[model samples]
Target: MSRARAIGCDGGGSGARLALVWDGLRHEVCGGPANVTSDFAGAVAEVSGLLHRAAQLAGVSLEDLRGVPAHFALAGVVDERVATRVAAALPLEGVVEEDRRAAVRGALGERPGHVAGIGTGSYLARQGPDGFETIGGHGLVLGDEASGAWMGRALLKAVLAVEDGVEPATALTRQIAEEMGGVSGIVAFAAEAGPSDFAALAPRLLDAKTDSAARHIIVAGADYIARGLLALGWKEGGAICLIGGIGGKYADFLPTQMQKALVGAEGSALDGALALAMEQDG
Candidate 1:
């Protein structure tokens, strides 16, 4: 029997993760500051480096990787064109799936139903054994209106409001700014933040959800998310698992109506990647 090895990679805007699974054991290799969809060469190089590292750690060589299959999950990889571009960047032979799918697959344990991923960015998708279909996830600039970036942007607007003397900066806003370093720091950091960074800030926003402005923004994001989920055909009867930073962390804050929409889950994106790697090709 040919020994099998599974490789899974999730490349977000903030960072990249390479997960390797073999013989019921899982190992991870990380690579930098790259978004494959946005930076073609950088994506290729980062992914290559991650793969090389994983192989090294696993005591496997490049020659060993030539035969094993990889399941790659990448952020900002939307549509077939983006997938094709990333496919070229990866050297391993196997299947390619969008980060959202990978995340959902990971989150849902390859099961079916509707899943909403709200993190630095937001995306809603449906998956079944047959395949997966996307509802929304256009990134912060266009879509992702209900995501962490959306909240961060709203928080910034609130800060602007405070600056303009429209209203005092709430305690929550002050705390968020302080925790984030400072107003100037947030400005500087946001200027170059990736999806993961924005998602990572969900906690700060949640902390301030009590304030009027923070509440407004968080509810607005949840509303957008709920709308996206409904658009994807998520029904109260179906299984709906919320993934991503905001989704997982702020589960309690979601409207009761939205809460009733979800069932339960087996694992997370990380687990999903491990499971994806474990499956053998027919």
Candidate 2:
């Protein structure tokens, strides 16, 4: 760990990835979710444990990573003061930044392009010489349109609308209502659901084939995707790399010209984080 030159982390609602660099070699480790907003102390503890495990995996101790410069790309870090506090809990000298930048970097590298990452959260960004210009990713309550969490929450709300006799109750609504024990159960689930909890409900919507209501919800999310893309200055033929679990699903909803501009990711957030950590070392 003392021989470590840099540390890089890609952390989100699902999990965390850490890369320890020594000379030209990189040792990577995986750990629990590190979304600081959902569980601050837990996130710090998970990171601390991962670094300790990484040190052990490298046949060293946590003490050896004393001054390593770590660049952490973590979800749920909106407050600068909170970032500073998270940094203080790390085993090494580190910086905490929102996960969106890493998504953009990993998807496009230094090449100018746009990125639409839609997983538990959503964000759209344009990568350029001045760094990333982004929109959305305000988390579930205020924003994150087209995200898994958003889609899931929308589905439940639509089901409730069906209960109220305002919206049509398609087969999808009936199925969900039945499974959740009708109106009462759906309401209960919503009451306690966090982003990841709500996101777990998106797969049914994702897997829909003949459900009109499901399509409607997804289409609305796609509309936001189009808006976010345009707001970031996307035009016909502009490269847009989709990232995360739900990003590719929206391509069909966007205009055909925009779909034509879609490209596969060059790397992942972990790669971007490691690259940034290396940059900090230099």
Candidate 3:
């Protein structure tokens, strides 16, 4: 008989990762974006390809996945309808959950706590005995207030402010204008830039650490996150783990009260995916 096996997939707007657990061992592989809500077919293909790669890395054949349970924690799968559509496209027996749940589980395990995931996107989630509750993560336009994408957008706006003389022309603004090919270039980029494209500019803000504009933007975003924690019922001295690309950077800027609650994540979203897959297997 084949040994017990399962796959855990974490799919975000920027990329997807697959973890294969079998015979007390685990293997991982990376793939392209898998936001099924945005591009169902493309996401499906990316996830499928990643699964195959993961299986191969584990010295298993694609056929070996027949009875294996797979759990997918994906972005853009907000409801049952979207989950159903994504499930129908895959050839596996598994469950699909929102990325927030996965991040919570990954960061906190079964412990009742809170997680603030701030990367290309941002979300605040709390998990307790009853279940999980999430706030923010409405995407760049609607929310994601403290996310990298948000910071990038803010930086772009500052560039515009400089051009229009609405704000002082700081070193940060001058650099952004030059890098983006001046005000006209920014206008063109904005016309077609996706969230990820804007998020890509976030590093520039970090690089411009000494600039007053950069400091202001970072602090503003941090304040939004701190406020989110309070709104989500984060109690004083409660455990809160920050996860994602920009999560750590925001830590220093968070209110001192909130900082006391910050703790290291026990694991990653991939681990959470695996935990969910194991539960399903039983």
Candidate with top lDDT is 3
Residue range 229-274, candidate 2, lDDT tens digits? 8988888988999888989888788878888999999999988877
In model 1, where is the ten-residue run with the lowest total lDDT? 273-282
Question: Against the unseen true structure, what C-alpha lDDT does each candidate score?
Answer: 0.72, 0.85, 0.86
Candidate 2 backbone collisions, by pair? none
Error of 3 at 35 (Å): 2.0
For candidate 3, write residues 113-208 as lDDT tens digits. 888898988999898875789989888999999899899999999999889999998998997899889989999999998788889999989878
Clashing pairs in 1: 106-272, 120-199
**TM-score, candidate number 3:** 0.88
Better of 1 and 2 by TM-score: 2
- Model 3, residue 111: distance off in Å is 2.0
- lDDT score at residue 26, model 1, on the 0-100 scale: 73
Report per-prediction Cα RMSD to one decimal. Answer: 4.1, 3.0, 3.0
